[model samples]
Target: MGVPFEDFKFNRQILNAIADAGYTEATPIQQKAIPPILNGQDVMGIAQTGTGKTAAYVLPLIMKLKYAQGENPRALIVSPTRELAMQIEENIKTFAKYTDLRVVVLYGGLGPKTQIEQVNRGVDIIVTTPGRFMDIYLAGHIVTKTLQVLVLDEADKMMDMGFMPQINRILEVVPVKRQNLLFSATMSDKVHSLSANFLEFPTVIEVTPQATPAQTVNQHLYFVPNVKTKINLLKKLLDAEDDVKKLIIFCKTRTSAEDVYKFLLRKYGENGVKVLHANKGQNTRINSINAFKADEVKILVATDVAARGIDVSDVSHVINFDVPVVIEDYVHRIGRTGRAYQSGEAITFCTPAEEYYLDKIQKLIKQTIPVSDIPADVFVEATGFDERQEQAREIDLQKRKENPDFKGAFHEKKTLTQRKKFDAAKAKKTGQQTDKRNKSPKAYRKKR
Candidate 1:
């Protein structure tokens, strides 16, 4: 009942496409961003994932470039990852369905022969990753002169992935007169610099505060003792909630992701669970995401690589199997659930060491996560000695990062247990063996 899609000044072709996509209402981002975009203003949109941010810019881009014109692309969208590039391509196709516009997606991890062929045929809009786009452009396959509009989606993620050099190179090639749109869920210092350099007194649109989780998401935290107890808590929570029809459990590493996937596979059967990580083949990752989106898979175990771009509906919950070492990734991981104005749950499991990161995440998001009591029925496994030592070491490192003056716990303990100075000068002068601790202080002082 907010602003409807028809209220926007879209053409019949776009209107029909929107209707066919079953999108009746305009999300907050769409409502605020579309008009400025349609006016051809350089806009910087700040919105969270699943707030219909992709379509917010895509719709206006399609409206501006109504039909196919030449062999080269008129507009370009540079995404941080291949998954996001593919998602943007799908959105463009969905909205530009009625028009004769030709759009193609280019990404690495596969041969570019097909993409090069698509461009040769005729492409009005190109959606691609920064690295692959640069690769094709350097090879003389892309025409920068034809690009009238350029969008950098998930600019923060791109910055995190170290795509700034390529982005700068792209800026150098593209015409400066063209419209520039940059969108991101969070605004880091790097993003601010990019905006200052890239945008030309542009209008800034922020639907939500930077790094804030969506209002639709209810978050919970649990302090788990060890990896074994974390798994137990995960099982207990899943077994208790029948409403968790679809969920994603995010781990920090590929090994942990695989282990969680295997555990879920045993519990839910092969067809019910899938795993996605960088190590998985591109086709396998695509299929896994597609299945999850289609509701064919009830669970997806993934690393942070899958966190930024994969958008699935009705995700009942997102479980953080491990707290991300990168503080910014915390926002992206939980952003997976509670998408598209749907209410969802995000639960995080933190070990003693991970609490350091958890504190940083809370400060970034500007909110304290509610801690939930572990279920009485679940067994809380005791931490092994080695694991305990590792956790202590990690926590010490984290503390040192915060305050360089902080000598870590181990440093302090070592200082206490360190052997007293051997007093080599005294040994040389007195001709006494001072290195041995077994020699009594009285004997050493009494003389050789």
Candidate 2:
């Protein structure tokens, strides 16, 4: 057991809500972050995904803002994505269940009419994506003067999405004397810069190394030759692994996610499977996530962008249908499982073309993923000629990125063949001209 929640000296309402949520003990991040935040100190928190980071800050924020305030928000939480904003808002509501605090989540996908109305009605905490927050603030819907606490959740993701300018603007608009908090799964240079500018004499807390996977997650990798072989392997694993009760499959592209979702839908029917991607309507994505969280759906296929801020617990496994090109996302993807101290598995399928990214992921995670041999019972399909060439081309591109002077194998060979043809043509053209000149009277006389 970790540190008990009661040791922090919370009010009866917050403690009751914690008990209702079945959270008896605080995780490492919670233990370190809750105290400093409650003391009204600027804080920078670094931890991997699923480390109970949300509760670490949310619980304290609830304790501070015990009752509902005026129409304006007293606290603000900035998120990189609308999905993440909603997830944070859900956590706030879950913990603030017994309190009178009012929370509103603002995002860009839906019409602002309802969000504007929500703000007009009273709000204590505002969780919003940067763009939507700026839009509402500019439209005179948000009153930043009342804000006392400002939290930037998933700060690294905000940097990745290039929200720095909006963040700066937000810092300017909010009252300068307020408390600041920044939380991230990974601490990149960009995050460092944001922290330097966003905080002052702040408490810096890092529970684990940046981008480290949770210890509760058992990672397994398989080398797939192609898409068909990956599907074959996925089918075999799903059929054999009885423990894969709830799973999230991450695909590199929306198209791939849809294809995988369709396959799973055929097998499990509509009730068991759902797909989420940027192309999906906001309602569809939210519904898919809600269904998965409620245990109504057994599997969810999603692209990385659409999968952000998914806080579902008890997910048995996370399968990477395609290796993520963004190496940092590998941590986030696998971190979906093994949540709330539950033991879970993270299985990755790496095609030959994706091996370059797999290598990077291993390096970033500071450990090699255990490779599992394909079962003898499962058929390993042959890689097609075109697919093989594409894989080779992708590998060449990966190499080229590492060494700019390095010419790709296929392109280098084609260049040599073209050079020979060009030289031969030039020689033939000179010879033809010499022969024509010799046939002329003056040239014939000289030749004789």
Candidate 3:
């Protein structure tokens, strides 16, 4: 608690809202980004999720747009996903409770009628996803000329989701001289390119290294042999650990998430388990997230889409049921816990096939995840032949990626032998033909 929010000298309305939200001290990002944002400078912020980064820029934007102005929105915030867009809207509403600021959230999957109505009623702030924002804008429902500030939260995710074209289109339509704020967990090359094109001589603030997890999370890794063993280990942990009051299990795909959800449901019943993924309906996904946040569900299984936006502060554990292929997602997945300076645990299950991704994640985060043995009571299942072969192939692929000359177990010896024989035969035939051609015409006739 270095500096209290009151020290920032925000207006009375903003201060009151902050107090109502139970926020006193500023986080590191807020401390570094607030001043520059208040001064109306373009800012590029690199910080992990759950780092109070939303308020870092949001608070200042609120302070700058102190009062409701013209009919059109004066500030615009673009997020990568619908969940994150809603979360940002919620944050703005929390901090703007004492003011007359009107915020409208826009995203796809839901009809645009209500969103259009909200915008038509007149808004001061528009928090939206790139696609829906463009949709409503192109439909002539949104006014961008009056937009004073533009914020791109989760900039890296936006790049990953291929929203660059929409973002570039939006940038072209909006006022070029307005304040620009970009926040991302990692500063990848794509993110840097976006920042260079969007922000102008921006104040760059980095609270931590790129792709690093929060320090408050105690991380551990378990090397499981196969999927069945991974499930067995999950059940064993849930049954044995008394401290897992609230947990989010992250999977790599929707199908895997659904499988884990069904497993947990059968064991813990529907009341205790809920699943969230793109396959679920929008309302169901929202309900599942809400239930988990309210502590009504002991376990929530989800994919990486929920990793960045879930703001539950007391999540006791984050279990990576599948090692994320996208290495940066590992940071976001573990970030769901250990939020708001609270201590939490992150446990990851890595199968042999996923070891390659695990290695990349470890290198990206710049830390070796502590490996722990399976509990003695848990039954360790034997790896089947198919799974063993798959693991071997994956290992060989990883090695060959490191050294292209290295031959893998899957490399066909028969093909190599056949190639050698064919090459020798071809060389011998070519040599004989060359000898015949080299012989003089008279020598050839004498031999005949």
Tens-digit per-residue lDDT, 1-448, candidate 2: 6899989979999999999998898889999999999999999999877888988899999999999977899999999988888899989999999999999999998999999999999899999999999999999999989999999999988898899999999999999899999999888999999899989899999999888898899999998899988899999999998978899999999999999998888899999899989999999988999999899999999999754568888899999999998789999999998887789999999998998999999999999999999888888999999999999999999999999988888987899899867765775565533344543222223355
Question: Which stretches of model 3 miss by more than 4 angstroms?
Answer: 389-448
Residue-level error in angstroms, candidate 3, position 320: 0.6
Clashes, model 2? 0
**Each candidate's TM vs. the true structure?**
0.91, 0.91, 0.90
Clashes of each: 0, 0, 0
> lDDT per prediction?
0.90, 0.90, 0.90
Clashing pairs in 2: none
lDDT tens string, model 3, 247-274? 9999989999999999988898989999
RMSD of 3: 6.8
Q: If both were scored by TM-score, which would come out higher, candidate 2 or candidate 3?
A: 2
| Candidate 1: pairs in clash | none
List model 1 lDDT by residue over 1-448, tens digit each: 6898889999999999999999899988999999999998999998878789999999999999989898888999999988989988999999999999999899998998988888889899999999889888998999989789999999999999999999999999999889999998888899999999999878899998888988889999999999999999999998899899789999999999999998888898978999999999899989999999998888999998888877777888999999998888888888888887788899999999998889899999999999999999999999999999999999889888889998987996686555444354455566565445675433345536
